[model samples]
Every structure is written in C-alpha cells, then in structure tokens.
Target chain A: MPDLAASSKRPPPWALRILVLTYLTIFLFAPLLALGVESFREGALSLWQGITEPESLLALRNSFLLAAIAVVLNVLFGIAAGLVIARQRFWGRALLDGLIEVPLALSPVMVGLAFILIFGRTGWLGPWLSQFGVRVIFSFPGLIIATLFVTVPFTAREVIHVLSEIGEEEEMAATTLGASRWQTFWHVTLPNMRGALSCGISLTAARALGEFGAVLIMGGAITGSTHTATTWIFTAVDERNNGAALGLSLVLGLCSVALLLLVEKLRARAHERR
Target chain B: MRPALTPTSRWSLLLRGAVIAWMLLLVVLPLVALAIHGLRSGVPFFWAAITEPQAKDAVALTLWTALLISLINAVLGTATAWLITRYRFRGRRLLATLIDLPLAIPTLVTGIMLVVLFGPMSPLGAWFEGHGIYVAFHSPIIVLALGFVTLPFSVRMVQPVLADMDRAEEEAAASLGASRLVTFLRIIWPSIGPAVLGGALQTFARAMAEFGSIVVVSGNVPHETLTAPVYIYGQVESGDSHGAAAVALALVTLSLLVTLFSKLMVRWGVRRHA
Candidate 1:
C-alpha cells in the first residue's frame, strides 16, 4: 500500500498527532483520571471501605452473576442464530437480519419497557404467568432478560462474521464424509468459530456488566435484590455518596479496561491470522 | 431449486424453526407487546403521551444531543482514524486501544467519571460554575457523555476502509501538485464518504438511545436535562406505563429507521465500489 502521508507531503505530522491526542486526552482520559483520583482521594482504606460495603459488594456480585447468566444464554442462542443466519437461505431472512440489529440501536430503557409491557401485571403474559406464580419484572430473571435483549447481537454478529468468512466448504466436506450435522457442527464449525465465539462472549459479558437502563427499569433498582453495580453507583451518586460511587466506578472501569485489552488482543490476533 | 423433504433437510428445517421460535419469543414478542400496549389507549392518549411538555423536551434533547455528537464524532473520529491508519507513530497501538476504552467501560461509569471530573463539588467543576458554565446536569454534558460512549463507532467503522484503500489515487493527486486539503477532499472524501455517514448514523442512533450515562449525568431533571430514554424510565417509575411505552416505541422506531438506513448505505457503498 502506498503511504498517502509520505507521498502527499501533508502538513507536519506533529500537528495532526497533537490534535488527535489532545482531543482524546480532553474527552477520554481526563475524565477517567479524574474519577481515579476521586476514588482514591481518601486513600486505600476509604477505597476499601467503599468497595467492601455490603450494598456495594452485593451489587458487584449481582452484576457479575447477571452478566454471566446472560453470557451463557447468549452463547447457546447466539451460536444457533449465527449458524442459521450465516449458512441458510430462506424467505424473510433479510427481515430477521435487520430485526436482530434492532437491540443495538434501540434504547435499553425501551428494551426493559418492552419486556414489562409483556410481563408486567397488566401485560399480555402477566395474568397467565401469574396463575402459575411466576414473576419476571422486578426480579433477577427480568435483569437477565433485559441484559440478554441488549446484548443479543454481539455474539451472533461476531460468529456470523467468522462463519461467513470461514464459509461452508469444511462443513460440506465433513458431511460428505458421512458425518451427521451435529457431529459436523461440533467438530468442524465450532472449532473454526472458537476465536469469534470467545470474543463475542467477552464482548457480551462486558456489555452486560455495564448495562444500566434496561436493568434499572426491569429490575426496578431494588437494593440488595435487583441492583447491579451500575445501579448501585447511580444510587450512590443520588444519595450523594460520591466516594462510594467513584470507588465502584473505579473497580468497574478497571475490569472493563482489562476486557477492552482482551478484545484488542483478540482483534489483533484475528487480523494477524487473516 | 427444488425444495427437499429429506430427513437431513427436515432436521435443518427444524433447527431453523427452533432459532426462529427463540427469536420470536425473546425479540419479536416483547416488541409487539410494547407496541400493542403503547397504543392500547388509542391515538389521543399516545399523542398526549408523546406531546407532554417533559416528553417533548426529552425528545428534542435526545435529537439535539445525537446530532451534535454525530457531527463532532465525524470530524474527530475521522481524523483519529486517519492518523492511526496512514501515519504510524509512537504509541499508535496504545492510542488505538485507548480509543476503544469507552466501549469496554460500563456507560454508567462513564457518567460517573464525568461527575468525578466536572460535578459542582470538584475544584474544576467549581471553577466552571463560577464562570457560569456547567458540565454535569446540563444538555452539553449529555452530548459530551454520549460522545464518549459513541466515540469508537466512526473511527472503527472508517479505519478498516482506509486501511484497505488504494493510496495510489491520493499519491497521484498529490504528485500532480494538488494541495493536501484539496487532494483529500477530491480523492479521499469520495471513497470514505459513505463509511463516515454510516458510522455517523450509527453514532447518532447510539446517542439517541443512551440512557445509563445520561441518567447519571443529567440529574434526571424533568424537561431540562432528561433525555427521551431517561424520560421513559421516569414515566415507568412514576407508574405511567402507557406514556413510557409510547415514548419508548417512538424512540425504538426512530432508531430502527436510522440503523436500517445506515445498513442500506453501507450495502450500497459496497455494491457501488464493487
């Protein structure tokens, strides 16, 4: 590839570099640093106090638990969705393709509201389900469902991309060797999609960890019951417990940064392999 | 092609049906429920729900912030992408990773980061307040927070295109004495135009649907800072399910349109280039 910069002899590289770095510093790094300082402003003991507080710990635990649940569910459903979408030819396939992306674009709050409209007391499924003493909204199930809804596309999209690129040749070969569909999928397709599937899981888990709007709406932000870490931070902020809020944010931020680095590594590995 | 009813084909069909059923139960049904519930009170109620002063302001704020973020992100994101792709420099990898940082961080933490940095209690925030400017609980803060959340979309979207693009046209144009800006405008802009547009639209949709970060930063002040998603959440919390659903549906519909539009644009661009 020709070097556009070397050939064009554009303005000094430093100018553009400085501009880009300055923008990022002002917008991205600065706020994060500020939070870092605030979180530890009162030193290690205070940070520990904030994090080890029962409510904070429970919220953190809930966030991980809910995210893990969503990740497991997404892995199962997402692979199936990815396989069918990538490999199949059928009517209305394009419509499904479009619809699957809806969650990414739609508001999480709306996603939660949609579930409530179906599962809330006055909802279509509420009365029927209530007869069986089943509850969804304002519960852990609701939190998982909302997180699942918001994160539905990540794994499926990643797997679809990987599958599309890997194509159907190997699966066809396996089938021609008299392998059943299940065996072919498990042996041939799944191995090929492992990288993307893992990446998708990481992405899904990270997103679910950070999810707020949908969970807050669906789970109703009931402390010690439905409140995830993000909601707890919000509550901390609301109650003017800035130290606790900032501390929780610091922990979540670090975890996510680790996840981001993992994603970056995966992306780099994928590109290198490609 | 002839439709086959062989056992293998039947099994494949069953798998496909299973995926479809899962999607219907999880994705489609809830959306349909939301639509039905939102409109259950008829045209007048839906109209009133969306047109209430707070609802109207929320909608307006959502659009205004989304548009502002799109424009800002387009310029900065494109520049960042350009810098990274065209010019290799020290810390390029680190810069790229940092750019993707917001993606991994929970967005509610993003709001908290802003508060830690710029809330009234902080020294910098206090200085800004003294100057009659504010970051938290302001419309501009919403734009800023959403900008951070949506930061990676345009750059990530456009980066791959630039990497794969043939730089010969740019080199040739520059060799012909075309100025840097003119050469970029003439040669580069046309190539990446659709990509930037698509990314910008996606960014806009993301900003529009942003709830978690906005809720934390906006202080949820009615009519003043409450965004559409936050407003819907507030409505639900306030026991106005119909109103929340109506607004949620409107936001969902708008986002779906934008997302689909961006998808169409990308497809068209690919076909055009092909």
Candidate 2:
C-alpha cells in the first residue's frame, strides 16, 4: 500500500495542510484553550469556589442524574428495537427505522417545544397530569424525556449496524442446539453484541450528558431546582458570573473529552474485533 | 437460507409490542402532538405567526447560516479528511480525535468556549473589535458555533469513502498524464460525491435545528442575531405556545426534508457501489 501510494499519489501541498491546520486551530483548538485559560485565570480558589457553590453543584448533579437515566432508557430501547429491526420481519419496520432518525434531525428546541405541547399547562395531557398532582414540563422528568429523545438514535443505530454485520448464524446455531430464544439471545447474540453495545452506550452517555437546548427549555433553567450544568452555565453567563460559567464549562468540557476518548477506544476495539 | 433469529413465540410477540409501544410513546406521540398544536389555531393563524417579522428573520438567519456553514464544511471537511487519510504525519491521530471533540462536548460549553475566546473582554476579541470585526455576540459567532458542533459530519462521512477508495484508477490516471486536480475531479470526485453531499445535507439539517451553543454565542438579539430555535425558545418563554409550536413545526418540516434527501443520497451511493 505504501509503495502504491508513493508511486501514484503525491503528498498534498504544504499550503493546503497549513490552511486546514489553521482552520482547525481557530475553530476548535484555540477556543478550547481559551476556555481552560479563562477558567483558571482567577486562581484555583476561585475556580473551586465557582464549581463548589450550591447552585453549581446542584446543576452538575442534575445533569449527571439526567444523563444516567437517559443512558439506561436509550440502551434498553436500542437493544429491543435493534433486535426487532435486524432479526424480525415486521409491519412498519422501515417506518420505525426512519422514525429513529427523526430525533437526530429535529433541533433540540423543537424537541422541548414538542414535549411542552404535550405536557405544558394547556397541553393535551397537562391538565390531566396536573389533576393527579404530577408535573412533567419544567421538571426533572421533562429533562430526562428531552435528553432521551435527542440521544435515541445513537445506540439503536450502532446496535443495528453491528447486528447486520454479525448476522444470525450464531443464534440460528444456538436454536438448533435446543437453546431457547432467550437463551440464544443471552448466550450468543448478546455476547457477540458486547463491543457494539458498549460503543453505543458510550455514545448515548456522551450525547445525553452534553444535551443542552432541549433540557434548557424543559428544565426552565430554574437555578437550584431544575438547572443542569449546561443551563446553569447559561444563567451564570447571563448574570455576568463568568467565574461560575467558566468553571462549569470546564468541568463539562472535560467530561465530554473523556467520554470522547473512551468512544474512540471502543471504536478501535470494535474495528479490531471485526 | 437464513432461519428466523426469533420465532414468533409469545415472548417474542410481547417484546415486539413493548418495543413498538415504547417508540410510539417516547418519539412519535409527542411529535404528533406538536404538529396538532402548531396547526390548532388554524392555517391562517399559524402562517401569520411564522411570518411575523421576528420569526421570519430568525428562520431566514438560521437557513442562511446553515447553508453557508454546510458549504464551508463541505470544502474544509473534505480537505481535512483528505489530509487524515492520505498522509502519515505526526499528531495525525490527535487531529482525528479533535475532529470528534465537538460531538463529545456539550454544545453549551462549546458556546461558552467561543465566548471565552472572543468575547469583548478577551484580548483577541478586543483586538478584533479594534478593527470593527465583532465575533462574540454577533452573527459571525453563529457560524463558528454551528461550524464547531457540526464539524465531524462531512469529515467522518468522507473519511471511510476515501480510505476504502481504490487507488488503481488514480494511478492509471496519473500514468496517463492526468494532473492531480484532473484525476481527483474525474476519478475520486465521482466516487465520493454522494457521501460529501449527504454529509453536507446532514450538516445543514443539524445546523438548522442547533440551539444551545447559538443561544449563548449569538446573544439572541431579536431581529439581528436570533436563530429559529432561539426564537422558538423566546416564544415559549413569553407564554406563546402556539406561536412557538408553529415555528417549531416549520423547522421540523425543513429538517425532515433534508434528512430524507440525505438518506436517499446514502442509499443511492450504496446502490452505485454495489
């Protein structure tokens, strides 16, 4: 391959490489660096105080709780729907597949709006739910729903891709060996799906954690009660409390980067297994 | 012939029903409710709501900015992908990882990072302002934020196509005295064109619905900087659910169209490959 490439394709010009690097620096790297610098500029004490404040801590906790719930729900849906789509012949199969991608295309704000229309004060279900003393919008449940909606595609798509690639041979063999359907799934299909499953989970977690717009609207950005880290950052910035905003931004940013690294590792492992 | 992975037992039937129900409740029903609510005030009222000057400007700004960003990503992402695939350089892995960073980071943090780097208080931002080029809290920042969040779409879309691409044709073209640009246009472009287009369209769809980062970075100034999603947020916040839903519906419709077209492009590409 190296010989073929050397004989056929010349290295691209330095100018193009420089241009690409410069663009990335301005667009991605420099901004991230700026965040790190600004966060620490006020010294470690201020940064610590900013993040450890009651509101900021609550925001972080809320974000993590929502992300955890979203991850679990998405994984469940991913596996079930992935199996149905990949292994079963069903009515509306194509429609289900298409609908899975809808969340990806719709803006997060639209998602929040969609939920509010279904659960807000004058919404279809709002009055009924209120009668039961249950709140959906402007609460944690709303945050979870919106996060779940946006992160839905990641896991299911990954599972579907893995299932198609792995095929049904193992499961069919298991059945021929007198294994029940559940047994075949648990012993054969699930084991084979492990790598892809983890990959999907990581993707889901990252997306759920980073979710902002939908969560913001659904949670109503109320300080201690409904605010997630993302929303809190918005509020902090709005109030000119750059310290708190930068502190939380750094924390979330680092968490995202860590998740991204894990995803890359999982992806590489999946490729190796393939 | 392949056997069924799971025969239609009672268990399988139950699982399928549960999965379908879950999807309906989690994804489809809310969207249906949104559509109904958006149009509940009648077509004329919905039309008037969306056509209001502020709403119109927001939608227009979102579309225009999304279009511009998609075009830019198509070009730059291609270049970046080409560099990654064709070169064996130092920090190549780092560059690839950085490309995926936007996907991992919470977009609200992405906005904050941009603000930290280019807000009026920052040295770089102050320098730019001295020359009358306002980046933070201005229209230009919208491009940067959208570009940051949507960074990986085209590059990831194009990377695999480039990697799997056969070099034989290019070698032949080069041996036949074809220029690098000519070879690319004739041989490589034809193969990767659909992927690039699909990626760009996906970027456009995603950007149109982007909110979190833009909300913070663009400052959401009514007629000047507000994008559709942010405008919808405002409408919802200001106690105008119907108007918000109306605008949300329009954005959703446009996104659905773009997503379908992109999926079609992918299918067409696969057919051509097969």
lDDT of 2 by residue, A1-274 (tens): 2122422245667987998988788778898888878877867777788899999999989988888887888788888877888888878889988888788888888888889888899888999999999998888888888888889899899898889889888888878888876788888888877777788888888888788888888889886699988889889988988678888888888888888899889888777666
Model 1 TM-score on a 0 to 1 scale: 0.94
Give the TM-score of each candidate: 0.94, 0.96
- CAPRI-style grade of the A/B interface in model 1: medium
Q: Ten-residue segment with the worst summed lDDT in candidate 2 chain A?
A: A1-10
Q: In model 2, what lDDT does residue B78 have?
A: 92
RMSD of each: 2.7, 2.1
Question: How many pairs collide in each candidate, listed in order?
Answer: 0, 0
**List of clashing residue pairs for candidate 1:** none
lDDT of 2 by residue, B190-225 (tens): 889999999999999999988888888888899999
